[model samples]
Target: MKKIFVYGSLMSGLDTDGNMNGAKLVHADCRTLHKYAMYIYEDYPFIFEGRSNYQIKGELYEVPADVLKHLDAYEGDFYFRKLAEIECGEETVSAFVYFGRGHFFGMKEVKGGDYRAFRGKDGN
Candidate 1:
């Protein structure tokens, strides 16, 4: 199994979360050790390195090899998968994170790291 950090739709309790079927939850409400930029691409959220602003808030999961392979295909070629450190509770651990690549265009950056809150799912 591989540890994967998800900050967008694959997060638990969100649309496309079913893509994580068969994966075990490692942690919830976790943040990245390093900061990154997050923006809304269409209706979905995507993040990239540089211009660090916020430590992304998301979840961690232990996914099987098959599932990880599936995720790679699911994420397509635009999102690059890489290992990164994240704050899971009080411990920092390394996990596979997908960094999205695309044109910024008219994308709006999210102030807070939480995508749910940005989407108004948390009623914030």
Candidate 2:
């Protein structure tokens, strides 16, 4: 099993969660160890490496090799996966996070770095 951080669709209760059908949820209250830029495009969200005001909120999951392989292809070339530090409870661990490549011109910035809240989920 490998650790992965999912902030957008792949997170539970989201549209793309189906892609991670075989993954196990590890932590739900996970946050990026550092601040990063987050944006949304047609309801899809992507995170990018950069300094930002808020740490990206996400979830941690443990997935098998086959699931990881499927996620790589599901993310496509527009997004690249990289190891990033994540805060899970009082512990900090490295997990694979999908980041956007190149310019995301028209994408709207996600304030508070939460895709779920931004989309009006959870009554936020």
Candidate 3:
């Protein structure tokens, strides 16, 4: 099973069509080991490693090889897929996380580290 961590629109209920169509959700409270900052750009969310105490709220999904390829194609140049160890409840598992590789300037930071909450904001 190919495990992946999704922090933004890829999470369940966020994407209407469902990015993880054939995948199974493994954990609902997956978080990154390292700190990172998240911002909303063009109504979408991006997370980059930097000076922030935010743990990056997301979910862990176990997908098939075919599903992984589809996700890679969907992300494209928007992000760089990297291996990361995420904390899932009492266990720490290695999963693939997409780090934003594009230039983001003056983007609004999602203070709570949760994309869903950010989307619920007034101007979001």
Q: Show where candidate 1 strays beyond 4 Å.
A: 122-124
Ranking by TM-score: 2, 1, 3
Residue 45 displacement (Å), model 2: 0.7
lDDT of 3 by residue, 1-124 (tens): 8899998888877753277899999998889887788888886777886567598888899999999999889888978898888998889989999888865777887897888777763212
Model 1 over residues 4-117: C-alpha lDDT tens digits?
A: 999988888888888999999988879999999898878778888876989999999999999999999999987899999999889999999999887568888888878988
- By lDDT, the better pick of 1 and 3 is 1
lDDT of each: 0.89, 0.90, 0.83
**What does candidate 3 score in Cα RMSD to the true structure?**
3.1
What TM-score does model 2 achieve against the real structure? 0.94
Estimate the Cα RMSD of every predicted model relative to the unseen true structure: 1.9, 1.7, 3.1
Ranking by lDDT: 2, 1, 3
lDDT of 2 by residue, 1-124 (tens): 9999999988888877899899999999999999998888887788888657689998999999999999999999989999999999999999999999866669888999999888777522
lDDT of 3: 0.83
Candidate 3 at 7: error in angstroms?
0.6
Off by over 4 Å in 3: 121-124
lDDT for position 82 in model 1: 95
